[model samples]
Structure formats: C-alpha cells, structure tokens
Target: MKYSILVMASPTAGQGSATAVSFARSLLARGHTLHNVFFQGDAVGNGLANAIFPQDERNLVGEWAALAEQHKIELILCISSALRRGVLDKVEAHRYERAASTLHPAFTIGGLGQLVDASANSDRLITFGH
Candidate 1:
C-alpha cells in the first residue's frame, strides 16, 4: 500500500517520534511504499541540523533522516511550525536574516498544501502523536 506519515511530536518529548520511526520501518519492510513524511508541531526538531545526542541515547533525528535517505522518502518540515521553532533552511535563513541554515539537508521546508496533497495522493495517511 502507498502510505504517508504525519508526525506531531518532538523526538525528545517522549517515545512518540521513536515509535513512528519504528512503525515506518516495519511498514516499508512489509512492502509498503512511503513517499512522504510531514513533520509538524514539535516534530520539526527531527530536522534540526545541529542537534547532538549522547552516544548511549538514540539520535532520533538521524534515524529518521537515514530512513528517508534509504527509502527515497520526502522528509518535509512544515514551514510555519519550522519558522516558529527556528528551523531554517539555507534560503529561509538568508531571507529571514539568520546567520546560517539550521535545517537538516535530508528534509525540505513546505507548506500545509503539501500535507493536503500527500493525504489526497496516498492510500494511507498514518499519524503519530496527534
């Protein structure tokens, strides 16, 4: 089945993001097709370029990024939520007069329209953490 994911929790908030990652991987392994993952709310932290996690702990951001890379999935961060949380890409950072880009390269900034399009295009629209 063709699927898309909507993640709404921060990686550090709880296990919501982690669970989403695991679920996504499982679906793919079972022959599901995932092309888009939309990160909104605090979940946008998953696309932070400078986040550092301890060796013992899981770096959820990197995990999600790796999944996107390996699966050819589009990791999209909601532009409104991203800007509100200071997650800026190179173009946005420069446009907003920021010093540099703070968004992970694996993810792209997008509007809610993309979310709508994903929902319309995919057979399953799975959501995590509200």
Candidate 2:
C-alpha cells in the first residue's frame, strides 16, 4: 500500500506527531510505501532544525528526519503554516529577508497542493492530530 500522512499536532506538545512517525515506521516494516508525510498547522514545527529539546526528552524532530533519511521518503511542510510560525527554508528566508532558515534539510517547504496531490496519488491518507 502507498500511504500519505498528515500531521497537525505540535511537535513538542503532544503525542500525535510521534505516533505518526511510529506508524510510518510500522508501515515501512510491513513493506508499504510512504508517498509523503505532510506537516500542516503546528506540526510544521517538526521541520524546524534548531529546536532544542531537554537532554532527557526525545528529540522528535531528529527522529522524523532520521526516518525520512532512512526510508528516503518525502517530508513536506506546508509553506503557509510554516512561515506563519517562523519556520522557513533557505529560499523562503531569502525571499522574506529573514536572518536565517530554521527548516531541517531533510524536509522541504511546499504548498498545500502537494498534500492534495499526495492524497490523490496514495492509496491511503492517514491524519494525526487534535
């Protein structure tokens, strides 16, 4: 099966995003394909590269990045939601004259159309959030 995951939960505040990652892992383990993981709303924070977590806490962003890297899957963040929350990629940062981009290299900033395309192309569209 091909799956597209939509995550709307805050990366640091809740379990929804983490649960999505775990589910993605299980799907891969079962020989399924991940079409894309779309980070919408607060979940776009998961793509921020500079987030600092407590030493004892799980680095959820890192986990997501590693998962994307290991599986070679697309990790797409909603450009609108991300920019509103100060999560910018290099191109967007330069375009908006920001000091620096905080987006992780493992993820790419895309418009909502990507989410729609992923949903249309994938066999399943699973969402995790409030």
Best by lDDT: 2
Per-residue lDDT of 8-86 in model 2, one digit per residue for the tens? Answer: 9998877998899999999999999999999999999999999998989888899999999999999999999999999
Q: Residue 129: error of model 2 in Å? A: 0.6
Worst 10 residues of 1 by lDDT: 121-130
lDDT of each candidate versus the true structure: 0.93, 0.93
**Candidate 1 residue pairs that clash:** none
Location of the lowest summed lDDT over 10 successive residues in candidate 2: 10-19
lDDT per residue (tens digit) for residues 1-130 in model 1:
9999999999999788999999999999999998699999999999999999999999988998899889888999999999999999999999999999999999999999989988999999999993
lDDT, residue 7, model 1: 96
User: Model 1 shows how many backbone clashes?
Assistant: 0
